[model samples]
Target: MGDVGPYPWLRAVLAAFAEEVRGLGPVLDVGCGPGEVTAHLAGLGVDVSGVDLSPKMVEHARRLHPRLRFAVASATDLDLEPGSLGGILGWWSLFNLPREVLPEVLASFACALVPGGHALIGTHVGAGDVPRTEAYGGVPVTWTTHLWQPGELGELIVAAGLELTAQLQLPASGQLRPQVLISARRAPEIAPGR
Candidate 1:
């Protein structure tokens, strides 16, 4: 959060994926907490915007990246027109939702994309949702962090009309939690050729 930036490997991987959809259209940074990654993509020459459910978070993002766009919105019910976005970044955010809510959110993500639009989703790896009452840095906090098997989340993404392009299960390292990073793409149209 707060533009602290992602782990080196994670940052490199995301940047590479972002480059794949560079000229397609704007990328929606769903749950873009403090615009860190959103700013990263923008620096990479990709058209990007940030969206988070919390107004405070959006405010922080706006302050941090005033020239970029940041909106307060829910991933479960996006305001975007169908087939409008080129890519989506759901980094370390989807796991905060209940498992039952994922499909709807994933569907919404798919609907907000143009044909061939791409999405990169990241989440923790485990079996159940864990609730946390205290913050690590002494700040008060209340939230449940859900975990999932990579295959399970991939299945949900595929069911939501996007084709799963790749899935990476990274082992825990240093202070970072083990994570699952998934990349998917909306099916593109075939040209009249052969």
Candidate 2:
């Protein structure tokens, strides 16, 4: 799955925010299917790790980028220490989840990040869930994509204790749906009564 439409833009956005990740600590690429984005972060000298629910994807990622770390893990339930990660990339991954689960997963993203950490989340912009029953490119595949309005996802990010920093909605070209990219930062710690 090469960059279909707004993928290059998405990558550019991540590249722009590299400093936020660098300042905090290591980065985690959740739902990192084949570790392409994770590898990109690693290439930028960001301490990064990739995690996917499928073991096959993990194996493939390891084979593709042997030097980078990859693991089979669910986004909703992460095996990470609190306040540990500096940045997270959920590129083209969050729309696969059901709406009910987004809060939990977003909270997990927040939990994994240190105070002032950053996250970049990408998804298709639309009203509701879209189920794809047929395979693509002669490969047997079935999946559902849950679209969201930018405001909807922004609310979730805020609810997860992250401050909304930027929301970029790129218009659709040809067959592609309009994509929304949200950048959020975990609030910095505060001393009591300061």
Candidate 3:
């Protein structure tokens, strides 16, 4: 996935997201492994930075895209300023989080975004967790892949106070499970005496 750029559909989604958030505030790419997507948004002229749980991945991202900001941080422990971000991206990143932890994370995304800010998330589509012992190129790893049905994830997003704006579902192909991309936005704040 790192060798190839984002798929056509994903590129389109990301382009629209970048356009929506331009000049609103900085965008954070959570779980930004290797920083490819972060760089893509930057190329599209977005004010974007990236964070990942792995220090090694952060190092790689820094080396690969020196102009962009990359940090070692967990999605569960992000120190986001309230209403500071214009957008957030969880592209194929949050599925490893425990089911119970996801809602809290989503709520934080809601709290961290300025009114009218948007979050775009993509995840594998399925039911329960699939524990993995190896990853790409047979690299040994220990993590659980937690999957969600589209409706279930959408409900969680809405429950976190963001309004669902769009959903794209992709069917399973070859070794890959089906996946879903969802976009949600914080409602614009209302003025007093409206």
Candidate 4:
């Protein structure tokens, strides 16, 4: 419920991913809390658009990052047209989505992108949505979903047609416990000439 920085190493890893991935365009930051990562990507010179489920959070993001595009929408149902995005960053969002709904959520992510697009998903090592025992900044909300193993997360993305790229886990905040991270890309169709 507070703004958190991308872990130092995670930042470096993401930067490297950006450098290596060619032709990525205006990005979609899913679960883009207050749009920090979206702002960071925009700073990197990549055009950016973002979507988050929280209107207050989205409003806060819009105020802080008016230069970028954003909307209040579900990751499971992005309003964008097909083949319109270059990438997606689902940082700690799907945890709120039930496991049964995870695949559909990912399928929606896939539908929002063009071939060769990229997505970077972040998750915890073994915890589902923390309950809404309290509110953050006056907004009452509940966390959703469940813990996922490495292979399970990977399988979901692949089933949605996104290619697996890498998985990186970082220690949790204020502690050294591990958190699971998943990075993936959507593959393009094989061309006839090939």
Quick one: best lDDT, which candidate? 3
**Which wins on lDDT, candidate 2 or candidate 3?**
3
Q: Candidate 1 vs candidate 2: which has greater TM-score? A: 1
Estimated TM-score per prediction? 0.93, 0.91, 0.96, 0.85
Looking at model 4, residue 39 earns an lDDT score of: 82
For model 1, residues 1-194, the per-residue Cα lDDT tens digits are 22336567677767777777898888999999888888989988989999999899899999989999999998877877898889998988778888889998899889888899999999889888888776557767788988889998999999999999888788987866788889999999888893
Evaluated at residue 84, the lDDT of candidate 2 is 87
* Pairs that clash in candidate 1: none
User: Whose lDDT is higher: candidate 1's or candidate 4's?
Assistant: 1
Distance from true location, Cα of 141 in model 2, Å: 2.1
Tell me which of candidates 1 and 3 scores higher on TM-score: 3
Each prediction's total of clashing residue pairs, residues at least 3 apart in sequence or on different chains, is 0, 0, 0, 1
lDDT of each: 0.86, 0.84, 0.93, 0.74
lDDT of 4 at 125: 66
All candidates in order of lDDT, best leading: 3, 1, 2, 4
Comparing 2 and 3 by TM-score, which wins?
3
What's the CA RMSD for each of the models?
1.8, 2.2, 1.3, 2.7
Q: Show the colliding residue pairs in model 2.
A: none
lDDT of 1: 0.86
lDDT of 1 at 29: 92
| Candidate 3: residue pairs that collide | none
